[model samples]
Target: MARQTSFIKLEGTIGDVTFYKGANGSFARQKGGVSRDKILNSPAFQRTRENLAEFARAAAAAQLLKGAFREITLRAKDLRTHNRLYAMAMSIIKSDLVSDRGMRQFNLGDMSLIEGFQFNINAGWNTTVYARYTIQNGASDITADFEDFVPAVKVSRPTGATHFRFFFSAAAINAEANTVESTYVASPEVEITSQVTSGFSFSIPKLVIPDTTQVYAMGIEYLQEVNGNLYDLNNKVHNSSKIFLVEQV
Candidate 1:
């Protein structure tokens, strides 16, 4: 591998060398590796084949988890959310002791590893929301409760921000079935300088399935009021969301 310093940037393949632009810049590397067919069938590449198979499974699990929380993630997520989720999924899948190296799956692994995961690292949930809260998972409903919360001192608002909203989401995920049933309930916009907020509760519906895993999340976003309308901040970096709980059944 080598960096490309030529006057005209080169991309694509030139004989055995391939050039491309990566996150760090443009570079060139030799396109010479074991053939796909050889790696799949050869005895020496058994380890490689096993690793590839396990990585594919991890990717699928990551996609399922990401899709389950799409509603909240779509509003607030970092640039590397997918990659981060994939890495986390790999860690969880590796904990499966029953499955072989190439056949590790998410269902048999520890599902609690995803708890406390933040969607946006720029604005973490703990740093953004200072007020304490509790969540209780019921048979058919998920509830979030907050004590006497003074937003002026408890909440951290971005510059020129006047209002904020909260999101409570619950999801039922089945990895083997590749299915997700999820829903969310959001709180009304409140001014940053509002008085004590008590008796605040969000009753979000939960999807109860026979063999599914349950996940819950809470999100907070800062907004600015313009002439009676609410607008998101410049880059949405101030928004934060987190997976508060995970129940594997």
Candidate 2:
């Protein structure tokens, strides 16, 4: 390989210049300041080095996410779902990454957190007309149990409700306000309900979640049949908050 910069044995600094013996058996003089060792070891450069390291790790993490979620069914092949999920996953695991002066704190270091985590109904979705479900982690799957309520179904049931369904993603789930937007993924099944439910439960089948394809957010959608037409709750008239999301992990 050709030489890059000439290797030099530099002497003492002179004004803004320093005399040096080049590795190619030549003499040289150039602007000089601090020693290479001193600059490299300086505290000012430590943060830069740390930043470089963290960037490398984040890049690797992104690649790992791609590999794990390769089988993830998205709206498109090169969609940003996996990237969004990767960001979410890193916010949990690599959140505690710090510099030389940062206080060390314990945080999730890898994708292990996706294996098990608390699921909760989003605050916005805790509206009056929603059925309640209890989460249970069993040996085989995560079961959401819904039973009969005192008001015959749920406390504040969506009027004319006819269907209930589920969808999941690594990012915050959103529904089309009025028209169906080809933005997100929906679960395959939409259970038929009788405007009022007797209560229903769903057992989400579990699998060995890979770091690349881990799911973190889930949304439950309710549909109402009005005028012989099924309408979504997020039709702008329903406050556009139709999808009730559960934190999957």
Candidate 3:
């Protein structure tokens, strides 16, 4: 018999798996283990990190946009409320002055003597008059009216007078009696004793008129006196009075 020769296969093991040599005498296992540095620099790892970063940035931008939209919505609502309030006030003032029956008409221009009425201060007795209105859904609107009262007015007399007296009148019995004095008196009634040297004038405070049912035509009365307390007279002087009307929307 001729000499017989056989080749034994070599095996390699890694992680519980065995690799054997092939018919060509090449190892079935890979030549070398993967390096840590090469894995860290691989395109797959780099792409994954970049994807995570993009996600984070998108989330932050969404949050910022949401916050900005919320702020703008709130500001727009505030502006709308402010504009509505102003319109209501103006409308009430411009409305035709009529009696309960709507027969008689009182012109606003004739009633308001003082021009350019506005709010003076924020609070207290010296504060300017401001009207406020509130509305409820499916309900009647309510209005709160306000005005500054000038109690006494000063008038210059053309001549030197010793005594001065003032009287006011209204078309209808709309004038209310003085609450403190309980006397039937119109607005801006005054009596002065001092004489006029250069120019006679009476200081009067602004009149604050409350909403009343009797007011048809508002008027003012003026009276003057000279020399001693012997002469006495009463006169009705019709002057324009200003009333502010405010409505709630």
Candidate 4:
């Protein structure tokens, strides 16, 4: 028999066993070493194994994203847009994680999930004040391109407004507190409107992060003009979300 101190501690439940954090700043798995061969052969362990497999899949899927999005401020508590970046990343993982034959895997050289439309675009006076944007990123930079034709925007585009700011920051990996708190580097934003939509096509260049950072997070803040005033329209949680967009430098 092994002493409890001899093994690492675990914090949560996985499969039928529970894990905890030890006093020495290390992790330890609790007693009860159910053999894998026994689990595979026992009909009674069917549901148990199935659940274990499901968690295994979620864990692997999380790994594919965690490091990539440590700095993004994600606040959707229910794992939806309500939760912001975290929800978005998990949704992407859930969409891309596929189980075939007996194994699960992602489908790509890199998980390049690009989304555009509705939520990315906010409209006042219903949802057609005319706004459209694409938040795209890859192994290099992130680009936020959009057009606004809400009349007032034609003459009043404020660069200082966090209204359309894009951010990148460090990640929190330990399941502890978010390291970003409220810090992130803003992406470069240049007014490309031929005036504002009805003008012409425009392109906002890619965003870049500092060379010293690795694990990253990303987020955007949105604002709309009403009565000569700008108000927030973003659905971010806590403030940011996890990001998989890596800076290639």
On lDDT, who's better, 1 or 2?
A: 1
Q: What are the TM-scores, per candidate, against the unseen true structure?
A: 0.85, 0.41, 0.19, 0.36
lDDT of 3 by residue, 43-149 (tens): 75665455444344334323332232232222122223233323322332234354322222222212232122211111111121121222121222112211322
Error (Å) of candidate 1 at residue 136 is: 2.9
Q: How accurate locally is residue 60 in candidate 3, as Cα lDDT from 0 to 100?
A: 39
**lDDT of each residue in 1-249, candidate 4, tens digit only:** 222455454467678556565555645454677788989879988777765654465455454344434333232122333234334444443454444322333331123342321122222112322345554554453444555554334323334333343454533222112112223465543232454444323222343333222344444444545576666544442233334433322
- Give Cα distance to truth, residue 20, candidate 2, Å: 44
Cα lDDT computed for each candidate against the true fold: 0.86, 0.42, 0.28, 0.40
Root-mean-square deviation of Cα positions for candidate 1 versus the true structure, in angstroms: 4.8
Find the 10 residues in a row with the least total lDDT in model 4: 116-125
Tens digits of per-residue lDDT, candidate 2, 140-242, equal 4555566653332443334454654554334321111111111233544344534444555655554432222224334445576677676765422221122
lDDT of 3: 0.28
Per-candidate total of colliding backbone pairs? 0, 5, 18, 22
lDDT of 1: 0.86
Q: How does candidate 1 fare on TM-score?
A: 0.85
**Candidate 1, superposed: residue stretches over 4 Å from native:** 1-13, 17-31
Kindly list the per-residue Cα lDDT of model 1 for residues 1-249, writing each as its tens digit. 999999888999999999999989899999888898999999999999999988998989999988998987877899988889998899889989899888888878888888988899988888999988777778878787888899988898888889888988888888779899888888888788868988877777777776989888889988888999899766578889999888876
Worst 10 residues of 2 by lDDT: 173-182
